[model samples]
Target: MSDITVTTEDGKTSVCSPYDTTFVSKAKTIGGRWNGPAKAWQFDARDENRVRDLLREVYGTDGSPTDDSDLVTVRVRLADHEVSYRDGADAKFAGRRIATRPGRDSDVRLAANVVLIAGKLPSTGGSMRYPQINAGDDVIVEVRDIPRATLSLEREGSYEIVGETRGEVDVDALLTEREQLLARLAEIDALLPEPEGTETTTQEAAKALGVSVRTVQRWAATGKVEARKNDQGRWIITITI
Candidate 1:
């Protein structure tokens, strides 16, 4: 909900958000510094990749978007201790479910359908106080306590009954299940504009998205890609494929 803007001057870049404590803190990690006059955080444009990731992590937007459909939001129960969302600097700072037997849930996901914890209080009664989750690949969801609900996926993936009063949930199972839950996040285009003619510092947007650079640029231009840029100049854009 912030009017955070990322702009470039010469080869350096700066991020200006709506005086947010969380944003300013995250921005500082990527070498963002306070600019009294500009009233923004300044850093090198070459570090755009890191900046973009931080924005996505904290606000779900990398100061760019392909389009509206690319952004999504969903809801889920915090069901257990094994699950964690990436809405914070680390798992320790993530938001969490207050209950497990009949846990709380949020629909926070990246375009790739990766599950993420919302940066702020995503629901009523939900608190920002997160009990740290040990980071690992082990994803175990207590399906037995879950209510019956159908989950959707990104890229027209499929529907699955992620919640149920059934049996054991393993890491491998939750890995796939994570997609269903995260796929429901409140997706949307970035409110900020991309700097004109500046080349993107990373190909992650295209590569992780499994799209060509041209396609990525087109998505960026039309707001279809998770992040995109205009091609009004000779500069070429790339993402890590």
Candidate 2:
């Protein structure tokens, strides 16, 4: 950084600082601007006090002195929020405002738009919840490159979700589906016909008859279910569900 000069000429006060990125940046923090000819950093001439104060801080109290006379206030639109401070009506333009309103604050408004700023949409997907805005907050938005057609917020985008994820599949959902598949397979296996001499177990017969194992065993002992023990040492019975 270097020294800043203050001058008053042609009934206009102008503050100038060396044209450098770093110096121009710090100058702007105190409301200085680069609107003058030759690209010098300049700001409100009436801001002599503030300008001197900033220069003093940068170059110490030995910095150049400035003259004080007719004071002026320069107003620039930095951003907009409340109805009173806002400059123009965005409603006059054709576009859409898609986002949830904050229950507590009006500064931020966010819906189900993919957060592609860092180079991706939403990491996860779900339903659209409440608004995400707060009062006095500035939302940094950039224009998406739509080379051909006009771009409007009303149009669907890769950044926002217009609906829910009812049609999507996740891990837990796959597990549930697998369980259903296994149950269906078991049912189909149970329905297969047996070979000519094959028979069902006492328990299988009970399951077919919708009776208890003890009841099936008692019936088999009373010759109710045709039963035999196979060479494999398993109980067998003649029954059909």
Candidate 3:
């Protein structure tokens, strides 16, 4: 019921309607909903950072940055009228005059191996349809208002967006920690002296124990095994000849 005039920096003035004002105010209460495909699709660094940070914060030490290898391939059924894009080989690759194109081709050629990123909701069309995706199918992401450069994967390759909760952890730190733990475990195993009265040579013990010679060496290196050092500086295992 209140009247307010909104003026833009360009000197443009517009009278706000009661309904419009309410909608605008409500939008502010929420995150400011973006309607339509054009508005909904936005590729921004801040948004990308938000998603990345959300993942990292969730996974902790177990979470690491993954590339194409991390993506899970899936396939979804597409309606005949649905529009899809795919990579084409008909275009020229380099100045050498390639026979196939590199960009997206028509939907017909793209039917197989293309992953369904997003499709028209059945509710939008007045029908109840379930969206299903199968494993090993390729993923296709539509480039709308968002710039393609923001995506981490190759723009032309088939990919799938895996849906799973992941938390943030420093990968380098995690790897280092794992290596340290393994080293410590090796040291501990080495410190465990061979059972008393067991007539087993280092190589024989290693073979009988189903462990590598390097492991036996590690035991020797850490002084786990009681052995006699000959003049050649080689340890003769005292367990067994």
Candidate 4:
């Protein structure tokens, strides 16, 4: 028998455990908020993995709470595809099952009851990665932890699941990558030895210089105006007057 109990209420994972300094410390470190009313530590359901790990550490095994009471059921509207979750699929990432059974209906609603994890992984560049869905209608996705999850809709094409699986963002990795990029950028900027001038976008420069955007582009291309592309490959012009 496990000394800890894990349950879900109001979209939050509630963990009731015996008073252990180690468990309390680790739980607080993992952002578990104390709930006075329930006498349990409440956490974002997406952090279920971390909570389970803690349980495994303090207790010899993951908490014995296997009741559906611990599961959080959320409704997701899928367009052009139906999603079905297999029992015990949430045990491991590789074991996750998102079976899509498409039908004649334009939209299908599925209740993701046993889903503890959701959302796309972060990109290599440390920016957010938005999973593309079918663009017929706004598809509401279930992001387990946070209140909001960003997803994009591709126009005119059906969305393919491919080998993609939902996972939480590695915030530490993203922050470290961002810092390294910024430092490298600073070094590159220093090496360029270019004088900092009034930096503005092509559109803004065009409006300021009272010229057409095409004229601005022409000027930039011919070196008639000092302009360069930013990280996003957008034209940034150093304009006078």
Residues 1-241 of candidate 1 have per-residue lDDT tens digits of 1244676657677876544356678787778878899877788876766886776555445433121113223333233232343343221112112232111233332222235443332332233454333322333222122112111111122222343233343455447545633542322224435445433633544665677767766766665533433565432454323
Where is model 4 poorest over a 10-residue stretch in terms of lDDT? Answer: 87-96
- Residue pairs with backbone overlap in model 4: none
RMSD of each: 19.7, 30.3, 20.2, 20.8
What tens digits encode model 4's per-residue C-alpha lDDT throughout 113-201? 22313333222111123222222334434423211111121222332222223345556655764675586578677887656579898
Using lDDT, give the best candidate's number.
4
Sort order, lDDT high to low: 4, 1, 2, 3
lDDT at 233, model 4: 85
lDDT (10s digit) by residue, model 2, range 52-84? 665444333212311111111111111221222
Model 3 Cα lDDT, one tens digit per residue, 158-190? 323334323344477558656755865796779
User: Residue 84: error of model 3 in Å?
Assistant: 30
